[model samples]
Target: MNWLLVVVGGMTGAPLRYLTDRAVQSRHDSVFPWGTFAVNITGCLILGALTGAALAGATGSHLQLLLGTGLCGALTTYSTFSYETLRLAETGARFYALANVAASVAAGLGAAFLGVMLARAVWG
Candidate 1:
């Protein structure tokens, strides 16, 4: 049952990630990988909310396995982030590379924290 949930979550998350990436990338015209950044931050927010719900006893392992492990795991792409950073540096967009790292980390963390706080307020 747990595995099934994870599989279903992954199946949903993967395409969502790809479609979301494409949609975001299409809207932007820059070397910066906005798509990956957006998805990663979104995933962090979702996972954080799930964690807060779990902490508040509003969620259980099944939800964790489905959304946290499967959905978030598929939705966020650390590998793409790393690759884009490297590509930017190699292509002489070193500033963008550093900025991407800085912004992604800062925004992702902030989003996750905010999500947790929001969920705790709602569920706790």
Candidate 2:
């Protein structure tokens, strides 16, 4: 069941992430990976929101199991980030790998902070 949850969540999350990336990249200059940064940041925000909601008793364990363990587990792709960074480094794109790390971390933190603020505003 847990495996199933992850798989289902991954099926949805991966494509959603891809589409989001493509859309952002298309809308803007392709000089930077705005799409990847946005998705990862948003993923972090949702994870934080889920944690807040669960901790506040606003939702049940099953819901957490779905949203956090399933959705968030799929949404945040540390492996992808790592692999991409490594691949870039291997290919001599050291700058890109560094940018990926910096962007992911900064954006993810910003998103999580925003999510917490939004949750407090709405739910507090």
Candidate 3:
């Protein structure tokens, strides 16, 4: 079932997100939310690839549900991104907050576009 697929993917994705975040954060001592940014950008790239595969008729509803809806949904944390940005602003790191927004959006979009391009080239 679609729900089961989502659950299974989420089971894998959520912990991966956490571990990845921890790993990335451990490498950085700055207030910039590099961990969250990495995960979101990565998620966007993967989702874009999955979507491109679907569009190319290389994937099914079940794969979409499992990867796009579940894995990406859990891996990308918009709430955390928002919260961290807000915290940065509230804590007087306004420049970092703005930079985070700008960088994340730009990079995320670029990554998604690249993913789609890669998928289309490979599958189509």
Pairs with steric clashes in candidate 3: none
Question: Candidate 3: lDDT of 33?
Answer: 93
- Candidate 2: where are CA atoms >4 Å away? 1-8, 26-32
Superposed model 1: Cα runs more than 4 Å off: none
Better of 2 and 3 by TM-score: 3
What is the number of backbone collisions in each predicted candidate, taken in the order shown?
Answer: 0, 0, 0
Q: Give the TM-score of candidate 3.
A: 0.98
**Model 1 agreement with the true structure over 32-80: per-residue lDDT tens digits:** 9999999999999999899899999999999999999999989999999
Query: Which whole-number lDDT from 0 to 100 does residue 30 have in model 1?
Result: 95
What TM-score does candidate 2 get on C-alpha atoms?
0.77
Root-mean-square deviation of every model: 0.6, 2.6, 0.6
lDDT scores for all predictions? 0.94, 0.75, 0.94
Residue-by-residue lDDT tens digits, candidate 2, 14-116: 7787888788889985445567667778888997786666666677766667766777776667776777778778888888889989888887888777776
